[model samples]
Target: MSAPDLLSFAKAVSSGAIRVVDLTQTLSPEFPIIALPPEFGQCAPFRLEEISRYDERGPAWYWNNFTVGEHTGTHFDAPIHWVSGKDLPNNAVDTIAPEKFIAPVCVIDCSADSTADPDFLLTVERIESWEKQHGRIEAGSWVFLRTDWSKRDYKAYANLKEDGAHTPGPAAEAVKWLVEERDVLGFGTETIGTDAGQAHLFNPPFPAHFFMHGKGRYGLQCLTNLDQLPAKGAVVVAAPLKIKQGSGSPLRVLALIASK
Candidate 1:
């Protein structure tokens, strides 16, 4: 865009001609996180430590340290998060180009299906059907699955069973189609993972991680307010923390939508 175009956009934002929607879930200890099996490592929940509350430590400034997992809360998934893209260049969060932090988004609403079935899996047919209604999912765009899972209460949000958590996500075929055919920049979901909760049961388990990362794409998880976005035309800005060699990190996702 030219200098005038950029200036006009800034003015529009200042004048409410455009709306900025926050798509990130609140990061707190209460937020439910993904649980792992007894044999595997686990992600830590968000924690905060109060260093000083204007008492003694520092009268002038108040700062506290906190601990949390890389994938805690609403976070970004770098290509390096999966084995498929481990060897790819710029696969880590810190190394990825800043230009990629922003991109057009295609929100595919699967709320009804997900509400009917906790284990609902997005299929290629569903994606194609959505395309029939909306325009084609252009390359380098973020395709977000809107399941409204973020609205669930704490217990139901995790929805863990004796076997594992029951959640909605993309099927292996859908992941393949998005990566191979559409060439999306990344995939986002209201669920904890880009893949289904029982995705391990699928052939080539966790296909979203397998195919998307393998192609050096990205991922956003634990997102919210997708219902506020239109099917297309919104631009998503998801910039991850610059953790060196980090596989993933919590991020603040914002969607820029033009006013009608």
Candidate 2:
């Protein structure tokens, strides 16, 4: 009984066998924010007024009442966020199945493509090539787009200049293929949003958001640390705060990558 090594995975608690990788960007005022047209519902950028920094408000406590968009920071997107998935059961973050919050992940390296062009679209052909090397993407695992964009400066990360943000994302066809064919649990990105900067020009527009939500898949954005994981076998933990009737919520995402 004292031999934890004899148990199937008690080794998960053993030293040097597993590691936790933080996959969230810092929720700071300087982080680039998502943009919405002047007419649509607006997503507030994160802002906090220090209630007390170990001072008057509460001598022993330092906290703040902050206002942030449901999609702000390292956040999760529930199906209910878009009208396309509005009617589905458990469509909101508060209602989603808890089991879905933890799962294995596949980080598809797309940083080179993104570096070559800010508007790059992750295509099925590239995924197919990845599979050729990494094996078929297992169903129900997360497919994280690892572009390392989270490492860029705020101006470069957003790449916005009057027209809108310029970022990499899945092609519309690729999103459809992933949802319908690969059966991925969700999509994640290092950029400000999951869709490309100019996705409004694609058919049905914002295809990653459209198809992922419509199919009841989830989204993780404003992510980092993809550079810390291998292509396969990392288990991700992304449990959002239990906000009431939340369209979505910011969260701390962690990944458990296997060690040598």
Candidate 3:
């Protein structure tokens, strides 16, 4: 964009002609984290310790020390998070180009289906149906599956069961199609993961991670307020922390949309 175009955008933002939506869920100990079976390594939940609260430690200032897993709450997943993209260059969070952090987004609303069946898996047919109405998903755009999962209570959000959590996600074929055909920059979800809870049963399990990361694409999870975004036109700003060789990290995701 030219300097004039950039200046107009800045002016629009200041003049309330554009709106900004926060897509990140608040990071707290109460927020649910992805659960793994006993045999597998686990992710740590957000934890904080008060270093000073204007007491003896600090006379007039308050601060804290906190610890959290790389993929804790409202996180970004780099290609290196999975073995499929382990060898890919610039696959880690810090190495990814900064320009990649901002891109147009396509929000696919599957709330009705998700509400009807928690384990509903998005199919290519569904995507095509969406495209028929909204237009084709452009390359290098973020495709966010809006399941309204972020509105559930902590336990209900996780929806853990004897077998596993029963959450909605894209089918393997759908994921493959998104990566190979559409060439999306990444996938986003309001659920705990980019894959369905029962995705383990599918061939090449966790296909979203498999195909997306395998192609040096990205993933965002535990996102909220996806319903606030339009099916097209909105741009997402999802820049993760610059952790050295990090697989993934919690991030504050934001969306910019035109007000009028």
Candidate 4:
């Protein structure tokens, strides 16, 4: 029951040859949220207004109305998000190709570095070493950075202080290489962003977002469950909420790992 295409992948889910991994953080008010500076329009945190918890608002059902930023929690970022991809046609979430949402993935482990320094940046050399062990990262594949960063608590996850949040992510050059060379489908991380927290210091600033999206590539932030995947061969299924003309959207990021 091997999947030759997307439809086969869907069918594999039913037979259990391919398993679904919930690569998302539970969205709730308690989830440690990303903090953006004032002045710029801020991305809202995941907050739910209990429409009914089965006690008051509605007795028959238990549900809530939530307002969250497009990039909140486990989310997807479309090209039109930044000013770079602004003029590109079909740049927004709704306009992205549905097929782009599914692709194979390669996990680059950097747990030791992330543990030592919260602001570690993944370099191109690191990615190369990963390839040496796991075989080449195929074109149109996802390069997920496994930092084991999701194990941290709120205060540590954000690690914000007088300066800003500290987290591990792609170096500017690393992202450029991934796009131009490997031609990865996108990048994913357990941290709050695809770019390192101090990415503003990089020339062009936030190069991961700049080039990745400017080229119509995608991004996944606040991811989890990378440990469950092999170094390669797993396919990612990250479907954003079909918001009209939206820049990005919180999504359920699932990984399909084929069992031998």
Those runs of model 1 whose alpha carbons end farther than 4 Å from true positions after fitting are none
Give TM-scores for every candidate, taking all chains together and pairing residue i with residue i: 0.98, 0.94, 0.99, 0.93
RMSD of 3: 0.7
lDDT per residue as tens, model 2, 1-260: 45665563446635647888999988987777787888987778889888887877789998889988889899999999888889989999899999999899999999998999899899999999999999999999999998889899888998987888889999999999999999999899999888999999899899998999999999999999899999999999999988887878999999987776
Report, for every candidate in turn, its global Cα lDDT versus the true structure.
0.94, 0.90, 0.96, 0.87
- 1-260 per-residue lDDT for model 1 (tens digits): 99999999989988989999999999889999888887999999999998987777888777888999999999999999999999999999999999999999999999999999999999999999999999899999999999999999989988999999999999999999998999999999999988888998997899999999999999999999999999999999999999999999999999999998
Q: List where candidate 3 sits over 4 angstroms from the true fold.
A: none
Q: List, residue by residue over 35-136, the lDDT tens digit for candidate 3.
A: 898999999999999999999999999998999999999999999999999999999999999999999999999999999999999999999999999999
10 residues in a row with least lDDT, candidate 3: 10-19
List residue ranges in candidate 2 displaced over 4 A: 1-14
TM-score of 3: 0.99
Q: Pick the candidate with the highest lDDT.
A: 3
Across residues 143-215, which tens digit of lDDT does each residue of candidate 4 receive?
Answer: 8999998888878888887888788998989999999998888888999888888888887799989989988
lDDT of 4: 0.87
In TM-score terms, candidate 2 sits at: 0.94
